[model samples]
Target chain A: MSNTISALPGATYEGAVRVQEMGLCGMISLRGDHGDEKLISAIKDIMGTVMPGQREIVHQDERAAAWMSPDELLLLLPYADVRDALTRLETALAGTHFLAVNVSDARAVFRLHGGSAREVIAKLCPVDMSPGAFGPGQIRRTRMAQIPAAFWMPDEDSVHVVCFRSVAQYAFDLLKQSAHPQAGVGLYA
Target chain B: MMILTCPCCGVTGEETEFHQGGEAHLTRFGPGSSETEFHDYLFSKENPKGVHLERWRHAYGCGKWFIAARNTVTLEVYGTYAAQTTEPPQDIKDTLSAKVPGWSWREFA
Candidate 1:
């Protein structure tokens, strides 16, 4: 049997920050009315936590969920638990105006951290990367350089970013180049 | 780079974070409408040189659609509002009118 490989072959660094792939996480896209009592309860039962606030993330045990939009969320779980989560979510939201799609293989996640992680992200993303503007628990969808991506901060010094699987390598290269400490001087600046 | 705020998520980001949806508050012309009305709806644009109202989607943010009142010439933004409404809010129109004389969008003079 062919074995699965991580989108990123190995860890790399540009400046003070280290960039690495967070491989094979189960990513499920969920959409429903936040105000629906049943839906909220169902999610809580499955996640052991309520839906996160807009642009926020709710962490419980090893599971985490990020508010992807007003009525959408990106649920992250252990790759082994993906099927169970999907079945539970489907059964929970059965007939409602909801959509639960498993997008496990559609994305590649990258983790970046260090003192200059914010600067590296700022160089690639137009969104405010300041601690005051965006910090821990906040998630946002935006573009990295030229490709569409989403990012969230699990803490002040670390950022987790996701992009489509097809352009994972391209995005990784762009991030690596942008994360270069020397690249931020006169020429690229 | 112009900064556009998404009403839904309360995220303010550069124009690159949002996608321009062109002119807003358009009146759609359907099968029963006159040919001119349909043509106007399909092709006619205000294309104002000054203050303009437009639709924008925070495609990279909350992914919510919003309306923005801005000046094309100076790139000054007046305000951003939720996209659920069919017309520009009165406050936005008043702000534009106060900022630039005789400013109007269709009939909201």
Candidate 2:
């Protein structure tokens, strides 16, 4: 069996926004035609959830799927179940113009909590984080400082960020700096 | 920074959320086309100083590509539309005409 390690090495911060690395989750990049009934049905059968619409996320317990684009969805689940899920999905989507890639190691994910989580993200990304604009349960593919990243909010006080594994440390540092009380960055409304 | 609204996601955000894809509505010249045609298709671009239509992607938002009409000098975004279109819609043309009389773009111009 192969071993896995956290990108941030057990790093955790307690500040205005609590930042912690969400280590070693199974991530799959799924691309298919959402308008195709066969593909949709197969994905539903394998994932137990239909593909999410633009900026939408469908979550069930430890499994979640977020729409990456019009024709792409990112599936997140327990690391142990990845092999089983891939097999089932491959069997269901046979002979179709679809792509399922195991990208768990390609990216690192982090969860930010506390009341100022949104503001801290706002400092790094240009997308509107206000409740009126980007509310709870919405996912967006954007940039963190200069790094490509994606993030979503499960509730009013929390956000989950995923960035390329190579820049995991830089992303974490940027988040940590933004969470500082004296950072004093202006948030766009 | 300028704000652009994505037609796909209905999310209006800063320029950072969108990537500029340069001139839109180009007639792609592939193999069998003349040298001039290929040259025009590959290099010659209309860098108009006035109203221009462009291709943009909401890379950070919906991740869908789109098109936008804007002014180069004024930085005024006339509007944004779907990327699948072959040319600017009538409404976009009307808006551009209203903003600048006798405004024409490429074949439409």
Candidate 3:
């Protein structure tokens, strides 16, 4: 958690549920035609790396993930990177028309990293979150509030992620409620 | 419910997979579109209550984007295309060979 707690104003928080404010500055959706080999190379050149390709992600100076289908990739980096990245990317492929959308405000991130985080996330999310099934390095963008959210297994008990900001608060509430009756062993103490 | 055909995985799934693109005629925006016209464009939208071409994503299931011919009137869906693409240089030929993220557009097409 290199980033700090920068509060997002509009969304409400329970405060009752243990919440950690994860400020994900921005999300970039870089889309090129599937067979656009030239564009693919340009993306690799600008990012200094290629997209993981498929349901995988690689973290570098900027976090890149092969989300959904092959033609699209999701990139996450500080808000500062937007200008340079977009400019270099667009200039690199001037004539080639590609889709690069800035979705920082549209998405948010939250980590259920406490001792009971796994138990809580598993009960709420339909996807299998077992330590063995979803370990570090694996990424899945699935539904949480019926809204598309990205989830990744960063560690044994740490499920790091980014989701749509509109439903971020509700998604956090539902996850906390999944462990309502059973409080965290070391959460408060 | 709106049925969105996945361009990647050919099959009709719940409209849940797609993110609703407001109107179909969005591309028709051109020059001399006056301020009033822009107002009408932004505010007064043509929400066809019948069958129309809409953009939706295979959000939860396939993670693909396709065009869904949705009978907004009857709420029945007829078909979906991975790249009813709205982009020139259309057709799967150019983009088919390269691996599409999680799924292949060629395998199904």
Candidate 4:
């Protein structure tokens, strides 16, 4: 059997902020009516977290559920547990109008660490990156430079970003360039 | 830089985050309709200089379609609402009425 590999596996860059590729994250794209009792309970049972509100992300340990849209969610868990989770979701949602598919390999995740982490992201995205505006638990699906990406802060000093696997290199380079040690804009500082 | 708010997720963002879908509240004139009606439905569009209603997609955000009542000339946005609506809501109409008196478009006034 072939071992799974992450896009830009083991890549790391240290600039104003530290950027590292988060390898092999299991992600499930679940689409359905958010108001449906069956859908909500199934997600709660599988992810051990309640459905997140709009633009919100709920995380417990390695499990998380992020609201992608009114009828869509992005569930994160251990890569190896994706198969079992999908099966459980399917069985729980049988005959229900929903879509639960493993998207672990289709996307890439990067972690940015350091006090200037928000500034690095702010340079690329149009979102308000100030501490008062964008803090922990808030997830934003927006354009990073030119690619479709989503990011959320785990705390004041760390951010987790997800983008398409095809653009992993571009995303990494963008982060690295924006985080250049001497390029600090001091806007978020 | 035009700013827009996605009614689906309530995220206010720049125009780059949303995709303009041209005219809004378009009524389809499908088969059995006259050629003129079909042509108007497909090709003809209201290019009003003021108080224009349009469709916008939150392409980089929630990926939901919404409606916007904007002024092309003044770049004033009256309001945004869910795309499931058939026409601009009453509050939007009231706002537009207060701003541009005697303004009417298509079947709305």
> Runs in model 3 with CA error above 4 Å?
A1-19, A179-189, B1-57, B61-109
Q: What are the per-model DockQ values?
A: 0.75, 0.62, 0.20, 0.90
Better of 1 and 2 by DockQ: 1
Residue-wise lDDT of candidate 4 within B11-107, one digit each (tens)? 9999899899999999999999999999999999999988899999999998999999999998888889988988889999999899999999899
Cα RMSDs, all models: 2.6, 2.2, 10.5, 0.8
Off-target runs (Cα >4 Å) in candidate 1 are: A181-189
Which sequence of candidate numbers ranks them by lDDT, best first? 4, 2, 1, 3
Query: How would you encode candidate 4's per-residue C-alpha lDDT over A78-153 as one tens digit per residue?
Result: 9999999999999999998999999999999999999999999999999999998998998999999899999999
- lDDT, candidate 4, residue B43? 97
Interface RMS for model 2: 2.0
In angstroms, how far off is B70's CA in candidate 1? 0.9
Model 4 alpha-carbon miss at residue B99, Å:
1.4
- Each model's lDDT: 0.83, 0.85, 0.59, 0.94
Best by lDDT: 4
- lDDT tens digits, residues A63-136, model 1? 88888888988998887788899899888888889988889888999999877778778888887776678888
TM-scores for chain B, listed for all candidates? 0.92, 0.95, 0.55, 0.96
Can you tell me the CAPRI class of model 2? medium
- Model 4: residues >4 Å from true position, as ranges? none
User: What TM-score would every model get versus the actual structure?
Assistant: 0.93, 0.92, 0.57, 0.98
The residue-by-residue lDDT of candidate 3 on A1-189, one tens digit each, is 365333353333332243454664656788776467767676677666565655666665655544545667777677667768887778876787678888777777776665556666655555556566666665765666556676775556566667777777777667656656555443222
* Model 4, residue A37: C-alpha shift (Å): 1.3
Question: Comparing candidate 3 with candidate 4, which one achieves the higher TM-score?
Answer: 4
lDDT of 3 by residue, B20-104 (tens): 7655424454578877777776776655544455567666755655665555657766555555455322343233223232322
lDDT of 2 by residue, B1-109 (tens): 6688889877778898789999998889999999999999999998999888899998766678899999999999999999889989999988888889999878884
Better of 2 and 3 by lDDT: 2
